[model samples]
Structures are given as structure tokens and as C-alpha cells.
Target: MAEFFNSISRRKFLLTAGASAGTVLLAGCLGNPPEDVGGNAAAPTTAQPVANISSEQAPETTAVKLGYVPIVEAAPLIIAKEKGFFAKYGMNDVELSKQASWGSARDNVEIGAAAGGIDGGQWQMPMAHLITEGVITKGNKPIPMYLLAQLITHGNGIAIADKWQGKGVDLKLSSALVSQVKADGKGGSRFKAAHTFPNVNQDFWMRYWLAAGGVDPDNDIDLLPVPSAQTVANMKTGTMDAFSTGDPWPYRIVKDKVGYMAALTADIWKNHPEEYLAIRADWVDKNPKATKAILKGIMEAQQWCDNFDNRQEMANILSQRQYFNIPVDILIDPLMGKYDMGNGRKIDDRTMAPLYWKDEKGSVSYPYKSHDLWFITESVRWGFLPQDYITNNAAKAKALIDKVNREDIWKEAATEAGIPAADIPTNTSRGVEEFFDGVKFDPEKPEEYLRSLKIKKANV
Candidate 1:
């Protein structure tokens, strides 16, 4: 179990003025109990203002409403708001609303900030892409969105109910155990699994784990979308066999003894692309300066979050009543790359933990167009998208990725924020990515990668 911060007062979200004067305000509805302020007590220092943001770079608007699911992936956004990073870069009136579910975030983005919805905040893999093409939008009405930055990597895992403990349903399932699982799903009890929302990050993670173990996710299991909180409850009732999501829910399972994590996403794919920060395209187009300002704020926040020393404080801030609404203890281990998997397994490697800024391969905050291609290709593998999307008609897919992935803006923000040149990748692709199952995806030839897959819906 993780230790609690020395003195944490129960509190609710509050709005306050910015750190400096001159018409700037914090503008965020966040908790700020004096007891919860500051980073690690060992190295406490006053938060610094973002330098180099001249008057010319001031945002067109200081206020924007953004929605976020209360996963660790959204920490940068909350950190930016709580630590005054957003206000430091002229995003003074940014509102961080806790969304009920990923579905709610999707619906909110469609209506946008003008109406009672969000401009955008944290999103799962390929959500911004799908929303751009209107594949998962309301009535398929095509609500275009821009992919800004990847929020964090490796904070997620696939959790199996305690009933399956020691049943050989781990990172790699045995052939005999795979047959047993398939048989267990007979007579309409099909091994029901879930993700927060379907056809995206969580869903893909669950499906990949299953398929990699030779369990046909489509035919052998009943995979569906269930809200993260509800999935925990369902697991307790034995109604759900498994679920894939980010911390601190998975940590809650281990703490509450509801389930055991079969595999951390880190084990499946090291430093994989997780959730993202995106906004409505219209909002970005209307306020380009404001868009970059938000990016700069989040960029600084990501850098702050990557520091292990500040994770304790990060956990403390996120556990307030208005954020994740959980005990701070549940967050500490995962944030530090420690896991009590609730089975006989344990992981204490910091390198395998969630990373926000830099990782082994490079920048975790920069959105690579190649990563977008992988998500689209995975969608094709699972039949969420057609084969023509990436297999037969590759250029069409790249066109969509080019339009939606705003890496140029990320480069602009990096330069404006004084990010070192080596830190900013020169190419849109992160080169070829390899998975735990020996599957490799090369950005240059996505179709070949698709063809290498043995179990896929794509006609390649």
C-alpha cells in the first residue's frame, strides 16, 4: 500500500484568480485547499511562470471548457489547471470538467463549447481521428477534431476478475487454457469483457491481448463498452470477467481486492501511445494562438508530471473529491511504476510506469502521425474500419491522418516553449513499432503489417 500525503484536507473544486494580476484569472473549477498545495515536501518550490510567451502570443480567448475522464491520463490537464500552468500561458479561464464517461466526452465534443459541451480535453486512441471522419459521432455527422498531444503512456492494463486467479489467463494464455475459456463461454455465458468505450484505446488493448493469446476476441468473447466505474461494480458481482482501463481504477481493483491485473500495457507494448489532448477543429482554427497556448501549458505540465518526485503530490491533487474521487494511496504505486497485481505477480519497475513527457523511445507528449496509422490499422484488423482504409488504399488513410494529426502545431508549441531541438522529433512517424506478440508495424508500409496478421477481418 502507498503512503498518504501528510496532511490532506477534504475539499471541493474552487475557482480563483491567477497567480499574477493584469486581468488574468485561474479560471479553472478546481480544488485548492491550502493543505493540498505544492509538490513534494522534500523539494517544495513556488510554481514558476512560463517564460517567452510574449504579448504577441497571447490567446484570442482565455476561457475554454474541456472535458476529461478521471483516469491518470488526464493528470497533465488537472496538473496544468491546479498548478497554474494553463494560466501561466494565457489560458487563464480554462475549465476542467470531470466527464461522466468517454461517451459523454464524445457527445460533449460534438456540441462543442458554445453549446453546453466541451471543446475537447483527454481522449482515447484514434477517437480524435474517428470523430474527424464522423465514424463514431452522433448520426455520423462528422465533427472534426485535431489531435494535439498524447497525454501519457503505460498507465493502463487488462484486469481479470479474481475468479480467474491462477487460471492461466495472464499476459500469454496457454492453448489448453484458451480452449477452457472458449468452452466456459458456451451456452450464452460467453466470457464477457469490457472497455470504457468501444473501438478505441481500451477496446483495442483488450482485443489485442485476447487475440495475441489465440482467443478470437470477436467470436470467442462478448466484448463491449461499459463505463469504468460500472465495470468495477460488475466485476464484483461476477457479471464481468475482465476490463481494460487506466489507473487508478485498476489500482482500486487491487486495493479493494476485486480483481487482478493480467498484464500492464507496458508489458504488452512498452511506451505505447495512450490517450491524447485534442480540441474541436473549429475552436483551434478560430483561436490558433489559444490552441498553442493550451498546448504549451500542457507541455509544461507533462514535463512536471514525468518527475517521480512530484508523483506523490500529483496523486494527492488528483484524489480530491472533484477529480478521481478515490483515496490517494491507490495512486502512489502506479504513479511510481509499482504494482501489487493482486495475484502472485508484482511489478516495481519505474521504467514500466506511466510516462508523460519523455520515455525510452522519445517524447510521450508529441503526437506522431505514424501512431495514428497504427490505431487505424488496428481498427481495420478488428473490422472497426474497412480494409480499404489502410490496406488497399493507403494514401486515403494518410490523408485523413495528415489532416487530423496537428503535429505542425505541436512543433510550433515546442519551439515557442523552448523545448530542446533534440526533444522535438523531425519526422511524423516514430519509425517501426513492435508489439509483444512479435508484430511489427512500419509506417512506410502499413499494408504489409496488416498482411502479417494471422487473425484479422481485413481482406489482405
Candidate 2:
């Protein structure tokens, strides 16, 4: 009789516990996820199935962890989880870990998911290559990483503090601003600018824009790496002159009356390569099928994100506290390619929006090797990587790009996802790209491209 009583109590305990767990899950589905205080959040449990991957193509594993900074480029990853693309592709247990910053994302990728870090997610240009080469990793440990796909193109910009208004700070630096910078230098001060990470996409954008305006990035001003939130704060206090960062923050600057955008990356270089989706090399090798499944999920998500009709709902999902922690209003205008400029100059063009799957040039999702070459070549120009890294040793740089960029995997995943052959790119190169400054970069002859740049640090 006592044994029977104990069994009954155990059954009651489980029943009660199960009921409590259900309530919590329902709450999670009904509202924003619990605040991500510990650098990670619970897997989004609201799966509604956006695709139909067959059982035969089911992934080897249904679980993976990815890290992302709160920016527009991370939309595909977040949308895939929320809208059930991951679940449809048998990645039902995918976790979208919220990284505090790009540095945190890099560190998390190095440690991987097993050690309370991420397997990989979104990254800036050449970061995967640099990480693979041990140039940026902690202790210079070479962490092999694979560049899977470009997440989005042209959703970033440089913002200037409101104090610089009419002081001639725009896409091109005015002589007025230049003279002020020079005068400030005499007082042992310099115009201060910041990017989230050094020698990466944001840094390169800021530098390129400054250089194009005849402002030497390395010598004329004080450029430093700072987190997005801190940069915004500094802008408010009038201590920061300029900041190069992704959207939401830049838009927030205008919305909060702190600053105005100097130039959209789209204006600087139309259809430029932005952030990307990459994964740990070890994780991809161990679970090749799963890797492809994740890619298929992201591909579907990218297509969905590009649809203008879906952007309103996309803004809602991205604004959740667990993701960007921003208002939906700030995101919708940018997603629709409408900008107020905050300085009496407004732009409203769909072609200028952040593109995911396809754009005027071609497949925005395809990770072209040529794009990788351009990043490496730019690194050479800025002296971030050794000069011979690309100028004198083209073959060596190409070999590294070939090793890190996995466009073949993207093709295989696209095919398996039933994407049409017409949509798949035939060539690895995107051809010559022209900048707003009229400078062109040809992947075929990076040496000549480097030679044409008058403001570059590379001797070649």
C-alpha cells in the first residue's frame, strides 16, 4: 500500500511539472523571449513551417547554436528560427545566441557551442579568412572557419554627430570639417571616429569613405574600435565625431536626434558585400548534412526576407527583446529602403534596400570568390594584412580564399532546396565593381587596382 502511494505521488509530481513547463512555453510563444542576460537566449519555439524538406534530406542533427550581433544583416538567421524555416529543414532545435558585439561573436566561434559559445552565424568581410589565418583570434589561434553565404548586401552606413551639421560632414568631407580637424590637432586633439571591429567591414567602410574624401584615415583622425551602444552614447555626449556601423543603430541616431547618416554603404558602393553566414570548419566537417540543412533553411529565409510584402512582419520579429531590442518603427523604413537622412536629404528607393537573395547585379546570396578576393585585396591596401598577401602573392591569397569560401556547398544546398538553375550563378567572379569615388576594383588584376588607389598604405 505504501509503495502504491509513492507511485501515485510521483505521477502527480510529473503531471504538475509538465503542466508548469507547458505554461512557460506558451508564455514564450505569446511574448518576447526572456531577456538574454547571460549572452544567450532560449531557442525560439514558435515554429510554423515555411518550407517542405523531405524526410530523405533530413539533417544528421537537428540542433546547432549560432551567434549574431543585433543588426539588420542578421535578419535571415533570426527569421529562419522564428518563421520555422529551420524547423522545416530539420533544424528544429537551432539556437540563435545573441552576441554582445563582433568581438564576442569571434570569441564565441573560436570556443564553439560545446564550451558555452556559438558554432558560427553572421560575420564581417574577411573575418572568416582572418580567423582561419589566426590573425584576429584570441592568442592568434587559427580557428578554421567556412564562409557559407553572404547574408545581406548594403544595409550599413556612417553616421555623424549632430554637432557636425552644416560643418560639412557628408559622403565627402568638406574643407570646413578638414580645417577644423587640422586646427583641433594643434590643441592635441583630433576628430574621433569609431567602428565596431578593426580591419573588418565596418572599419573598411569608414576608412574607404574617409580616404575617398581625401582624408587620410590613419593619419588625419583618431579611429578606434568601439561597441555600437558605446559609440551611440559617445555621439550623444558630442565626444564622437563619426561612427561606421550597421543599421538600427544608425537609424536610431537620427530617431533620437543625436546624429544623421553621412552616407549609406549603398551610396558609397552600390550592392557592396556586407556581413555573411559562416560556420566552424570542424562543425561542418562533422555534420555535412546538417550544415547543408542550415544553409537551405537560411536560403529560404533570405528569399522570404527580400519580399517587400513580408518586411512589416519581419520588423516585428526582429524587434523582439531577445533579438535587436529595438522598436519596429525604426526597422520598417530602412527595410523598405526609405530614409529620412535627418539632414533634410531623404531617399526612397527599393533598389537601395538591404537585399538578401537577389538584386539588380545578381544573386546576393551567392558567396562569390571574387568578393572574397576584393576584401583580401582591400586588406592589403590598408596594410591590415601584409602587402604580399595579395599584391605580390596573388596565388597565395586566392588559395586561402578557395579554402575558406564554400560556394560549392551553397550551390549544392540551393539545388537541394529546389532553386532553379537560372538563379544559380555560373561564374565565381562578379566582375569589376565601381565605387562612388569612381575607383574600380577588378578581381582579375588586384595589383593594378591597388596601384590606382592614391590613399592606400600598400606600396604596390
RMSD of every prediction: 8.4, 11.5
Residue 128 CA error for candidate 2 (Å)? 0.6
Across residues 1-460, which tens digit of lDDT does each residue of candidate 1 receive? 0011101100111111111111122235343453333221221233646544688898999988888877899899988887878889988788887776666677788898788888999888888988888776655668889999999989999998999888788889889878977886675567888777667888889988998898888888887666666766788999998888888777778788889999999989998999999999999999999999999999999999999998888887776655665666778889999998888889899899999999999999999999999999898888777677885557878989989999999999889889999999998889999899999889899989988988778888
What lDDT is obtained when candidate 1 is compared to the true structure?
0.81
The residue-level lDDT of candidate 2 at 218 comes to 85
TM-score of 1: 0.90
Model 1 lowest lDDT segment of ten: 1-10
- Residue-wise lDDT of candidate 2 within 252-331, one digit each (tens)? 88988999999999999999999999999999998888999999889989999999998887887777665665667788
- Give all candidates' CA lDDT scores: 0.81, 0.81
Angstrom error at residue 393, model 1: 5.8
What TM-score, computed on C-alpha atoms, does each candidate reach?
0.90, 0.89
